[model samples]
Target: MQGSLSEDRRAQGEASAGLIRGELEKVREEGGSGAYGVFGEQRIAAALKRLGCGKEHGVYIGNGFYSVHTGVVCVSGYVTKDELTSEVHGAYAEPQPGTGPCVENRGGH
Candidate 1:
């Protein structure tokens, strides 16, 4: 189960990268300031929702970096037990979604 979950996180994170890149590029094209939250939270949420991972997930984007947090979460600002952050280019995941008190480490903006 853990293996599968990790694989899923990796795959999902990689897959979402392209979408995020496109959105960021669009912002740049539109003359938007190169700043965090430029893409807005609603847009990010909508984009991630398409991935179909319905446990706990979110996205954080800033400057030229982006991170996607999925699995091992129960909702925004919360995490499950056995919380382990498997990071890949700012992205993170876990073997399986736990039920702990792992607050989101959304990084400094």
Candidate 2:
């Protein structure tokens, strides 16, 4: 039962990652115009890498937000779609407290 649950979560995370990747590609192809344009694809890519969701890593999306979690850090944010432009907007990274290295090491001997 536990194994199945973990598998299910992994599958769900993969699906969400695919969706986020597709959206990101669309924004990049469109020259990063709109809300997504502000941060630009490169910046997003860097954040994703830091969060362990770069091209070589996996992403996790939950409740309409995309996130990447490394052992020492996590970054989560939303990718709003622009109805008019059919592009992604408002893509921002929200730092997860207590997940970063500093937080994890706090008060540790």
- Which candidate leads in lDDT? 2
Go through the candidates in order and give each one's C-alpha lDDT. 0.38, 0.40
lDDT of 1: 0.38
lDDT of 2 by residue, 10-108 (tens): 555455555546655454456544554343445456545543465333344332344554322333455434421111121223323333211122232
Check candidate 2 and list the clashing pairs.
none
User: In order, how many clashes per candidate?
Assistant: 6, 0
| lDDT score for residue 32 of model 2 | 42
Off by over 4 Å in 1: 1-9, 34-56, 61-65, 72-109
Candidate 2 Cα lDDT to native: 0.40
Our tally of clashes for model 2 stands at 0
Question: TM per model?
Answer: 0.36, 0.32
Pick the TM-score winner.
1
TM-score result, candidate 1: 0.36
